[model samples]
Target: MKNAAVMHPKDRPEGSEHNECRALGQILDRVGDKWTIMVVGVLSRGPFRFNQLMREIGGVSHRMLTLTLRSLERDGLVSRTAYATIPPKVEYALTDAGRSLIEPLRILSNWAIEFRPVIEKARAEFDSRQV
Candidate 1:
């Protein structure tokens, strides 16, 4: 993490002796939400209007998407632009800080897809023992 500005404490391996390694829990609290990942992933491609985002990311309600974008914008991970038009035109894009997240998020997404089966099996085994 010497070269990086941000280091997620969750990414650290176990058995570390530094108790203060858990300092960036706020970042995790913000970006670790399920909606944030998907929204950011979509925005990483390019700017999108509100309806476009809702369509691209199916199953997210209008209110939820609005809230997600607002939170991301507040956290400096997303930018919102409104154009002066007849009615109004709005778009959302990733800020520089948000762009920095794309690579790390891509890596994490790959890890999730790759390990899903193994994780599911582990969950089943643990669940069986609980009964």
Candidate 2:
């Protein structure tokens, strides 16, 4: 009854499209790092210095945090500033693009937190069945 000759993309508009492959790869690189998500969440509240970030994100090593921040800065998601102060203060802040990702991250975190009990139970059952 149907002549299905064309296989059009269902999710994209006829003329409007994007580089989804590149976008997915870059996004995965961002969220793939646990510390990056934590750092983004921390900075979403506002800017903070190196020490403040260290304090906010518990258990994050100086090296790892520095690396994560550098990655984010390179990706244009975060901006870093340095001041010629007595202690030579440096601070980190999120760009507009980074700020826009906060809601999605919050949603992801909430889902993980809210589903923890169910997820744990499922894992337990799965492990027991495998035994």
Candidate 3:
């Protein structure tokens, strides 16, 4: 199926596209990535600087964080604010629609926890079969 981003309504925000499949891919691209969801989950609390996001998300490389943030911003789920200063000031926060994702993420979290054993078993089986 086409990604929702590409087929989304024409009235969508500037950074957002109008194709349904493109939009779907954009969403999956954001949440399906381990780091993007974590970033959004953490940012749901409030805005944070890039370094702060890195600290909060943990184990994420600077490049990956940058990529994730850029993609999220492009998808209209996250916004970037910049301030002029000696070193420059920047922060990331969720848009209202991005905020709406928190509840669904919570549900996904619950599902991950509940099905972890099954998932792990399947993972191990698949890994072993590949050997």
Candidate 4:
């Protein structure tokens, strides 16, 4: 008896492409997040302490920044280092993998900047049509 969980890949209709897309979607969900993008952009400059990151990124709440850092760390894109001192200090920096993301992100950023007026005009047209 073949268990559904153990079913062969040949048994699946969507096959490997579906699985590949699902994996890509999960990664996109992480990297495509606004906070993640902002954090990555700031970190690309250099390492930053927690408070420094908050100040530099602006508008990120304490908890949100903490969560975003944790998520980035979990994905191995960012590294966290702690120092022993009277007041313990920690800093966050990008790993090589994270650094590799900068070029693609920069291209995407440039594209968005270039198309902003066009997008805004399209949105206005769409909104007017909806009325």
| Count of residue pairs whose backbone atoms collide, per candidate | 0, 0, 24, 0
TM-scores for all candidates: the values are 0.81, 0.79, 0.74, 0.87
1 or 3: which has the higher lDDT?
Answer: 1
Per-residue lDDT of model 3, residues 37-95, tens digit only: 89988999999999999998899999999999998998888999999997999989999
What's the C-alpha lDDT at position 55 in model 2? 96
Per-residue lDDT of model 2, residues 12-127, tens digit only? 55433355556777788787679989999899999999889999999999999999999899888899999999989999999998898799888989999999999999999999
* Top-TM-score candidate index: 4
Q: What are the lDDT scores of the predictions, listed in order?
A: 0.88, 0.86, 0.87, 0.93
**Candidate 3 lDDT (Cα, whole model)?**
0.87
Report the C-alpha displacement of residue 108, candidate 1, in angstroms: 0.7
Return the lDDT, model 1, position 85.
100
Clashes of 3: 24
Better of 1 and 2 by TM-score: 1
Q: Each model's RMSD to truth, in Å?
A: 5.9, 6.3, 6.8, 4.6
